[model samples]
Target: MTTDEDELYDADEDPYALALRSGRGPVYLRLVDGRRIRMPVHRWHEQPTVADKTVLERCIGPVLDVGCGPGRMCRALLSRGVFALGVDIAPRAVALTTAQGGLALRRSVFDRLPAERGWKTVLLIDGNIGIGGDPQGLLRRCGGLIAPTGCLVVEVELHDVEERYNARFENLQGQSGPFFPWARLGRRALNSIAADLALSVTDQWSSGDRCFATLAHQGSSFDCPDAGRR
Candidate 1:
């Protein structure tokens, strides 16, 4: 559930906050093409922005928020009486979620999750698909987390390029995490990514600078996309 970073930061301290004071914690996605995109990490800690609310409005059923930091989206869903659960590896994030009257668990997406293949919607907002540095693997895992007809709403890069990179989480203090595989996919790349895993993109939308796509199994029936195989 909790990670080493939980021990590194105090109960009241958060990486985003620290980054704000020091001006450097924003996670950067360094592509192989010599292009690096700086993520708006601080936005995750603030109240749900208009763009985030627009994305939340698309949910139609029980939702699972992957890499839910501080649980802003979870809180918003709860206010709508929606059944939502936020999971993150950071203890403080889970605590913050529950503190705000939202359901949260300290866990990793790669680990066992509740109600596998049963959720109506699984969200990969805020560029969370980059978690664990394997976008394809994460998308495949999300394919199993949602119901056969369920939709996977993912927020992707707003560019027109697709790239994979080694990512690291760094703070204003210049502290950085270990290098991990990560990826950036724009609207043009969604179909290719989904088709690779036998999934398909059903819809694409944008709010402000944020872009999202809805994914589903290519077949009409419901079955774990990665079931019976690694």
Candidate 2:
């Protein structure tokens, strides 16, 4: 019943603290400085900002931040009084997340995820669908992370662009960067993935052309007038 993610996030030690000690938190790293690479040194959250006020206001109990590089999202979850834990594949990112007072662990999603069955939310923003370049798998993993009434919140843009290998995207700093191997899922993609995991889209919102959707294990509550729809 327990997974490797459970062991990696044990409460005793801060898994990502060592990375900060080495000071590589500023940007992604390149072992060879080119094509086929190891993995991205995910950008740590720089400043504190509420990306989603309504859903954040509703986060509960323990939270799991998947692909938690340097723990920015995990730290944000904690700010709401949720016992937050950050899970990542990079030792460096693991360090950063813990340095920020979060329970961080260096582990891949392919391994077990932190086992908090009743967690209120599992955050997958920042093109998290790119994990292994499979959106269905990502949502399937998130489904196991949510409590019965809990939600999985994700962000996407209304626009579409060339889908390529090791895709590039602008960071919070507005600097062009490699967000690699991402699968751009639009509204239709979102609905399909949700159903694949047997989850229902409950609420949605949009700003400008960007959109956010909240999926719950409960049936679709896409009744909100402001909820983004096709």
Candidate 3:
């Protein structure tokens, strides 16, 4: 079983090692577009408006940031009048979030989720498309963890699977530097994942040269959040 993620290139570092060592990671402003650059780790906690407004308007109920990092998005949401929570496999990340006056948990999405169905809106942004190996599996797992009316917002690189990661991919990516054969999960892939998870995307947009997708479980027919219902 894939318990912890590490870089095959480093051979002695966790996948998050680069993130922790450099104290920085990329934040894709949009769900697609695919380009991400390593930025200051503080930026992850700053809560930029680029990705925050999109989530604030569409997400319903408490929000969960899967891989919440230093609570950047979480902090942004709180400032926008939305209650947010965070989950990350990196202990340092969890600690950073809590230090920022946010509710965060130190756990992997593979272990156990803190909330039940329709309980909270979960954010799979910031390269969350690669959360659990396969995007489909990741979304499916999210489906089970989401509440009946919960939402799952995702972000992916909007590029070819191979070219994006610049990888040949024998088994899986994760064996090197800033590049890996991570599937971009563009529009087509996003739609398929949403369908597989019994979800329907309600809104999408781009910011800071990034693209994003907002998905939700709305019974059978897809619909937006309403004042009466939510």
Candidate 4:
């Protein structure tokens, strides 16, 4: 079977990696229908924003940041005296994180992660819920990675929509990378998936134009009582 990790091997020549190194974008996620979603590589490389702080404040110690592209969140957490580890399939991303004094590993979330089921919090920000084009499968894997008392902090679409598609990275200079499976889940879709996985949506909130949710094992309180509170 071709695992999710197998699909995400980073190449030195990938346009996304190049963009990360340059700290500039015009990088985009091009869908099969030729529609493009502009990726915020610049924002990712910059300091965490107000919306990002909302997510950051909810994170407890020993946080696992999935698809932690450039590691701004992890770095911010470290500054806050929180233990955070970033995991990414992209080598450049990991290197940047480490360079910024944040600890990171270049590995897929689907792979054998350290301290499985023991993380205090797991993050799926920057539209990473779309990884593998399989939200249910991804969440199921995250479920196993999180401790019983830990919660998943996810950023969902601002509107109600659910989609799965093949996508590739494209740069403004007309360069394109290989296609990969991806998915998008709105709040309702995420709630449905959590219910099916025996998880519950304990909280949902919005920051600016962004939306977020907290999911935990059924009937369990989060490790941090004030998580997601303003």
Candidate 5:
């Protein structure tokens, strides 16, 4: 008889989880319109890239990496002697992170997390700003996760597009997982949402095909060693 843990593992046999365990993927996010957006799984499994460095440089110590997939960012930060913690809803993700010597927790951004409002840098990289398909709600939650002088670093779409819909994880072979709520926000859309949350966009820049923005509380200030060097 299969145990409940065995059943749980069996039920997680989706493309995303498989890719994480194997460290490879041609995984795609199948949108409701039938359009597929390719997910950069290989990059997530590898060491930090030049583009990733751009994000890493802006981060202050005691960082929180929301949706940290394979834990590359967390690992990188720890190697740099920066205290970082990665959180994800996937067990495999947290396992891989700790296995690689990075601190991680299997938890959702909306769930109760440690160090509430005390993290110096909160990251929503790899399109995680779209976590719940409710960008405004997500941003509000992130605002509460950072210190008053801390900042939130987010990666936005390269193009000008804002959308919310259900999406599935699909492999190249056409196998797919259950549909879940997802969203996409360009820089402009992110800025608008940040404004409503009383968060100010402190910086914005592009590295290769990815675009990023930094948001902070209206009157608070924090030290980013690489600020303005981009």
Candidate 6:
């Protein structure tokens, strides 16, 4: 299977590889617009926090964790007897997840994934909604990947901006990798993106600094968490 289509880092010396090998320090996303987003590489090895547990508790059925770096969420779900699988484009990420006793595959979300249209929950957390730099396209794919009654559980930015961006991997030392495509969607922007794909925000909630929303196809009403203002 192909690695993540948006992966632009060199295998020999990518930020992910360095982080995985050293097991510490910084990895950053350098946006083409001269912005940098920090990625917490160490958190993948840490236990699930309240935000993670909240998301896990909200999951309905068989779960697919996309862009599952190091598989912390997947491992947590499995501990609760929930069938969860993690997929990532980084081989090191896959290895780390598996090494930690979590089930994971080194594959892209755009590729042929297992259990098509059978998953009950598809997770796009940790800014993973930004993958491929096309929120609508990715959401469309996730819509097709889930069962008719399934829902998408997503974590979005806290702001109100929605835009596609060119990004790349970088480290604290100022070294950078090739530019790739990415996107970001906040709750308001997410609403617009979801509506375009005919998805309805069933529920929304927040925990600490993170925000999450659950979605299902329009007109298919399902009891979600406390409804947040649309």
Q: Across residues 157-209, which tens digit of lDDT does each residue of candidate 5 receive?
A: 99998999999888766677888899999989998999899999998999999
- Per-residue lDDT of candidate 1, residues 1-230 (tens digit): 87544454563543332322223345654444555567676787678898887667777558999988778898888888888998887766776677678898988899999999989889998878777667888999999988887888889888886766775555444654555677667877777889998887876777788888878888845321321121
lDDT of 6 at 21: 37
Clashes of 1: 1
Residue range with the least summed lDDT across 10 consecutive positions in model 6: 221-230
Rank by TM-score, highest first.
5, 4, 6, 1, 3, 2
Winner on TM-score between 1 and 4 is 4
lDDT of 6 by residue, 1-230 (tens): 55442252345643445444334368888878888788766666689888887788887658899988878999998998889999988777787788788999988899999999988899999888998899999999999998888899999987777989898887767666677788888899899889999999988888888899998888865543333211
In model 5, the Cα lDDT at residue 7 comes to 36
lDDT of 2 by residue, 146-189 (tens): 77667777765565432324544322333343344555677677
Per-residue lDDT of candidate 3, residues 65-101 (tens digit): 8888878777776877888888887676776677778
CA-lDDT, candidates in order: 0.74, 0.58, 0.62, 0.87, 0.86, 0.81
Stretches of candidate 3 off by over 4 Å are 1-13, 21-42, 160-182, 218-230
Q: Please estimate how well model 5 matches the true structure, expressed as its whole-model Cα lDDT.
A: 0.86
Off by over 4 Å in 4: 1-15, 227-230
Q: What TM-score would each prediction reach against the true structure?
A: 0.80, 0.66, 0.71, 0.91, 0.92, 0.88
Task: For model 6, state the Cα shift of residue 215 in Å.
Answer: 0.8
lDDT for model 2 comes to 0.58
Off by over 4 Å in 6: 1-10, 13-22, 221-230
| Residue 137 C-alpha lDDT in model 3 | 71
TM-score of candidate 1 on Cα atoms, chains taken together: 0.80
